[model samples]
Target: PQHAGISLLRVLLGFAVGAGAGLALGAAMGLSRRVDDHVRPLFTAIAQVPALAWIPLAMLLLGIGETLKIVVIAKAAFVPVAMNTSAGIANVPRALVEVGETFRFSPLQMLRHVVLPGAVPPIFTGLRYGLTHAWIALVSVELLASSEGLGYLLVWGRQMFWLDTVLVAMIVIGIIGFASDKLLAAVEARLQRWRTDGV
Candidate 1:
């Protein structure tokens, strides 16, 4: 339980930073052609690299510390988020924008009434992906370099030939991942319902 808490904290902290940055970048890209042109190429290139590939470089720069783990996890969370968010916003119907303009809606009003609601579904999708990625990255980092967390428990148990402990940790990780996915799905459903119901 202590290990679970530690790992959860790491995921939450890293995810928070990643989500914030991703949303901002995605919003900018979606709203501004110039930003999209400048950033999209770099983002796509980085997204092609596997999360594990960052470990060696991150460790070199940050020395296997909590910062390294957080940075790694943030990268994992950031990509899907930024991608989905940009896609969602870019796909917002031109008809809706036209209507907003017809009504002379303020920029804030248009975003609040049209852009955000249109983007909610994909944004939630991004959240789900980002969270799963974050969890996966956290476990990987813990397994490779940490003295604690559930992933470390799995590694330690294996090293000590404690197969039962290793199995338990593996099971725990799977269960946690599944549960988080389901919870996010539920939240997405609720948000979608609210949108449909004019809430």
Candidate 2:
């Protein structure tokens, strides 16, 4: 239970950091052709590297600590969020944008009333994918280095040749990840309902 809490905390912290950065980057790319042209290719290349590839480098730079775990997880989370967010915003209906323009809405007003609503579904999709990635990365990091968390539990069990313990940790991890995804899906569904109603 204690280890589970620790892992959850790490996941949340990392997800927040990644999501914030992703939203900013995604907004820039989605809103500005110039930014997209400059950054999209670079981001795509970097994202293709995979979070696990950063482990050794992160360990060397940040050491095997909370910061390292958080950074790795954040890297894992941000890519999907950024990509989805950019797509979402870019795909926001032209009709809605036209309406905003017809009303002479300010930029912030257009974003709040037009762009964001249309983009909510995809944004939520991004968040869901981001969280899944974050959790996976966190476990991989914990398995490689750390003395606590479910991933560490799995590693410890294997090292001690405790098959049952390892299996239990694996099951628990799957269950937790599934439950988290389901919860987010539920939230997304609710938001979609609201968006439809508002429209």
**RMSD per prediction, one decimal?**
1.6, 1.4
Q: Taking the tens digit of each residue's C-alpha lDDT, what string does model 2 give over 47-137? A: 9999999999999999999999999999999999999999999999999999999999999999988898889889989999999999999
lDDT, each prediction: 0.90, 0.93
lDDT of 2: 0.93
Clashes of each: 0, 0
Candidate 1 yields a Cα-based lDDT of 0.90
Query: Can you tell me which runs of candidate 1 are displaced by over 4 Å?
Result: none
**lDDT (Cα, tens digit) per residue for candidate 1, span 4-93:** 889989998999888888999998898789999999999999999978899999999999889998999999999999999999998998
Q: lDDT: which candidate is best?
A: 2
